[model samples]
Target: MSQNYPQLDQATRDELVRAYIAIQQIYEEKGSIPKDSETILKRYQGLLETLGAIHLGLLVASFSIVLNFFIVNYILHLLP
Candidate 1:
């Protein structure tokens, strides 16, 4: 089958990966977190948002990587 997504070019993919890495780094650096538990929770929420973004990117990439290849080969075989 053909790709379902709109225009998701290489630059968009690269930016998504970069943002995901940056969010991951921030989440790992607990030392930078504030002393209050509430503040830490707030920071964690931001981290979760980043994680969600990363997860979405991975999902889209997987569709392109796995399904796209199969569709390409099938279409190529169909062509004379």
Candidate 2:
């Protein structure tokens, strides 16, 4: 089955083309450089630390939501 795609305006299409070209240029420049082992390790470590913090924050938020849900439900049940 053929699926219909949403039509984009001329301005939007032009912007997307510009973004694609910019990204292609960036990829070319990035591929030209091979960083030292230490530098690459440091960059990866920084990325890992950032992702870890994000995951920790999400875990805390989820735990708080679950705890609050139980507490709220317990309180509501006690009112009867």
Candidate 3:
């Protein structure tokens, strides 16, 4: 990815490389979120937020379907 940032100064590129190493170390050791991951995630918050909204919608739809099934089977005695 640094190849894509040819215009970046050496110091800036070094910082980014260090950040990637830190991030990789955290992920490898914990198998979960790393400390200060919010800094990275914030960079792509718009895309992440959109994905979160879609996930929430799917969860709610699934719950609604389950609730409807219960209503039909128990409340309305429509299923055996």
Most lDDT-accurate candidate = 3
- Candidate 1, residues 1-80: lDDT per residue as tens digits? 11644477777777888998787678667656443456655768988899999999999999989998999999999999
Model 2: residues with Cα > 4 Å off, grouped in runs: 1-41
Local accuracy of candidate 3 as per-residue lDDT tens digits, 1-80: 55887889999888989999998888868967655656767888999999999999999999999999988778667545
Native-referenced Cα lDDT, model 1? 0.79
Each model's lDDT comes to: 0.79, 0.79, 0.85
How many residue pairs clash in each candidate at the backbone level? 0, 0, 0
Pull out the clashing pairs in model 1.
Answer: none
Candidate 2 CA-lDDT value: 0.79
Residue range with the least summed lDDT across 10 consecutive positions in model 3: 31-40
Candidate number with greatest TM-score: 2
Arrange candidates, best TM-score first.
2, 3, 1
Tens digit of per-residue lDDT, candidate 2, span 1-80 = 01232477667777888998788778767985443335655779978899999999999999999999999999999996
- Between candidates 1 and 3, the one scoring higher on lDDT is 3
